[model samples]
Target chain A: MSGAKRGGIEVLSGNDMCVEGALAAGLSFFAGYPITPSSEIAESLSSILPRRGGCFVQMEDEIASLGAAIGASLTGRKSMTATSGPGYSLMQEHIGYAAMAEVPVVIINVMRGGPSTGLPTKAGQADVMQAAWGSHGDYRTAALCPSSVKECFETTVKAFEWAERFRIPVTVLPDEIIAHMRENVDTRCIAEAKPFDRLKPGKPPEEYEPYSYEISKEGAAIADFGRGYRFHVTGLAHDATGFPTNDPEEISRCNWRIIEKVEIARSAFTWTEKFMLEDAEILVFAYGSVARTAKDAVLRLRAAGIRAGLYRPVTIWPFPASEAREVFREARKVLVPELNAGQMAGEIEKYLTRGCDVEKINRLDGEIITPVQIMEAAKALHGRKKAQSSD
Target chain B: MAGRRLSPAIDIEKYLRKRNLPHIWCAGCGNGIVLGALLRAIARSGFRQDDVAMVSGIGCSSRLPGYVDFNTLHTTHGRAIAFATGIKLGRPDMHVIVVSGDGDATAIGGNHFIHACRRNIGITAIIVNNYIYGMTGGQVSPTTPKGSRATTAPFGNAERPFDICLLAAAAGANFAARTTAFHADKLEDLIFKGLGRKGFSVIEAITPCPTCFGRRNQNPTGVDLMNLIREQSCGIEPGGKSEAPAGIRLGVFADRDEKEFTEIYAEMAAGAGR
Candidate 1:
């Protein structure tokens, strides 16, 4: 571990921070493909994990990399895979398999621009919607966005904990900016952080069922692999016994449980940071690398005599819908500045009605949305709201 | 012929589900023959049923994992080797085997195939080569012979096919062999040899696909496909001179003693005083 000479925080890159987080989370296996901005993750793991009696393999492609991670997870190991945009598209089907089969695996998608091989080295938040619905069919995913190098380290460990606790795939969506940026990170504090373990069934092997949901007065429980309990897992809709079934009632029951586990655990999984929102007239909703720019824009707006604040979402998938609704009910206007062509804006519009105005400030030319652009959007929205009130 | 008659140690009937039976292969298709050989080898290896992990990617042969009773994963297309690599690395105590097709292994998964062989990880890879893509109809594959007529190659294939055994040998595999399903006993022996090898071991079983490749190539019957294998293959002795064609030689072509990848990795870690 690297540290400062004076016993303070050490300067580390976002990639190194992610490595630290994975190590702290007790990740034993890392299987991945070498894509830009994400290759450092594989490289670091290859060097560090082998020394710690852990495993690292550079898989042939992204799809297999994720599949391998799932396989490693099934055998009772904390496993993860990292990739960029095009590779993330290739991993969609297996992500669904992990969701449906309830396998605990973490996927790190360092976002880049693309519909197809668009910009490999550039940063973009275009994967926001894709992270939620990239895989086919109906299912919920736990996705986190980290703005700083420190959060990059902290959020990855959080992703592992949530995935193991819930027994589903958890995605950490960091753009190329956050993935490649270097900043001072407190490694000493992280070394003392506590990690969550997978839920283990206390019953004997014969009395246990792998996919059987035991509902107490509180909620459903997930069982850890090994320790004797055996059950079947498949890509198809399955029953509580983990056996494949096509019965409509069984399918409905299985699907709802998969969705409910995350929904019921929403309070623990959802994360957001609000700055000066109590008395703000204009609010900017942002996440990932864009959130950092939004913060600077808020400061610039405040200097320009505009009451603007930022609501940064740390978890993007559940979309922070409840918090957004609450913020919209209080603020007159909300500005969503993203790297994509209005992806997160559409998500925001879904939670707002006629009273709350949602404005989209988008850029899709493989460039980061600057603080100046967001400030301009916020100023424009504020001007329009003032004119409407005067009339 | 001199070896003892060995019965399978594991219960084959219980290990495989018969309800998924009357498999999709044509009558007398050599794939079933190859599958039998693999099951027998697994039984002979003496591994516990729960400790064996079988994985496959999409294709006709990739369906083998679904039939077996164990920790089985039916993964995405052409990625079985990669998945098996993860399993072998993550759980070194478990016996990991990958069942793949020629097109699946050499086309979409070529990079993984060569690199896995180079690493010489403790994994057994069984590739069933029927010379064409049987699942998606008779399309020309990486193992399709030059000038063979496939659905996509109506004018005969212009590209050269890869000799998988030679490729594995060049990529640093500890064990490599080629056999056809016509020689059932020989196929079983090679599979057992592969399973017993400590490093990356590859068994290329020349199988039959009568429904797609055979019907399209005008060899419509399953027996005709078997006859093709029987006529094309020749035996290669251990230390004796044998007259056999370069492409159709059957038997273990490469076997050498080397430290397996996992053990060497452990040794290096120990040397570093970890």
Candidate 2:
């Protein structure tokens, strides 16, 4: 396989962009299992990471892949892992562990159609819910969705930054379409995205406590292994020193701290691309690869003299709820077209005000929700809104 | 824990997180003995405390890391070896040790355990074979001998037990050995050799779970279980044959030079970078 040469503009698939993004984000280790749609990420990183003074390992399974990445991250390395639908399902256990342990790790899930191996080579946004609630816990993690190759690279870099800043695993979701589709991306522009790393313990080893909020208000300030800090990290609910505790107050604080920390930084993590959303009566909400098609439909609808606009959320989870509320405030009609069976639509419905006519077009036959289909739904939604307004 | 002194010269308190103790392991449980052996081994290895990282999965044995004053990580159940693989690869200079239970290593985490051995990635896996899941309350584990009674196996365990050392050797670990908690000195020695080895090392420490495994079987107390283990185990002869009956054979099973994952990776990585 030919590698992407550094510098200048290059045509690269989303998976290739992930490798470039990971490298740009100062990734020092990657451990992943080979799965369709996401395998290219593991394949590319396997060679590239080691060359850059990093380590890449093809782990035995998806669980181990995330497990290894978490371990590496704990040792003061910016580590990541990539996988697909079934593989993502396999990683949920460790995902919760990473959250509970407050390990900074990046996990990229190249979305494909599936409850289990439903469609390996095709795209689907069905994992939207899974990305948010796959792991059983009261926790929150930043999840990013990139619609194009360039966005893929940029978003992957941002994923690392968020993971580091929050001391939690951040997921980057790009469907099989975005993962395999090649597009032109400027290396210089993507490189401009800044990287973030966790805060290291500022005090002496003897004086340091691993998870003391009094030490740092942002990310975890635990010391790395072999650095003489000699701290403990555990998946069980723990006290400030990172030791397991059965105390109700300590456990409640541990659970709430992980969830509320991300929630507090919700505004910083919320990101969206509003296309012609100004004064548009018909606002279409979508994300991931399908958002690209929705944007196209919005453009086509505008040409046909329909007041349509696209609101695409790059940060899929933590849902950009406030922006959705503000954007949907004045719109008379809203439409959500997705590759899944109305997953994002349900999320959209949660934020909209009463009396707004909303419609959703869902496709689950391993085919993308085409722009024509979205335009039809938007037109119908617009028609109902217009008829009601006239009455 | 109050009166018994396993090794007087080692100054074991220096290697302990005293504030986090009294450990949660049940009374008469062999996890404490295994932990004591591991500590003694670490002391003998002469590695800097800062240069050692102890990782463990969920179990009574896995809880050992919490009581140790090292760069310890208590990860999810069945994933300690996988996590240790990452630590060893990330910082090859550090000595990484994984303390796992029989169930943690061979049941839910069986795939990762075998793959870690295959990679030979310079991790010392101290699989504490208590033959039952002590943390979860006497459940039948993958290492529980056939016909053994457990909470889950009210009648008797029908599945065959895994010989952890043989499994490690066959799976391509560079060093593999089996020693019981009753043989504390031997367990310490074996763990020391495992720490010194340059590739994946597996030390299956067969310890008693007096609260769970022992009470269900005929061995009711920790001492009884230790005596049972002492009676069943015999060292390998010079010719590598054991004269003991069909019981647990305790000795080194494999030790040979092979390319370790980190060294090979580093060499290859060194050549590729600009």
Can you write out model 1's per-residue Cα lDDT over A115-161, one digit (the tens) per residue? 78888898888688888899988887789999999899889999998
Cα lDDT, model 2, residue A66: 94
Clashing pairs in 2: none
Pairs of residues at least 3 apart in sequence or in different chains that clash in candidate 1: none
**Model 1: lDDT to the true structure:** 0.81
TM-score, B chain, candidate 1? 0.92
Candidate 2 residue-wise lDDT, B82-181, digit = tens: 8998898889999999999999999988998999889899999999998999877899999899999999999999998888887888999999999998
Which 10 consecutive residues of model 1 chain A have the lowest summed lDDT?
A215-224
Candidate 1's docking class is acceptable
Q: Can you write out model 2's per-residue Cα lDDT over A1-391, one digit (the tens) per residue?
A: 3245567887889998888888888898999998998999888887777767889898889999999998888889999999999999999998898888888899999999987889999888878999889999788988999999988888999998888877888999999999999888777755576777777878999988877764223655657888889889998899988998989999988888888888877888889999999978788888988888899999999999998999999998888988888988887688888888888788788788888787888888889888999999988887887788799
Deviation (Å) of B263 in candidate 2? 1.0
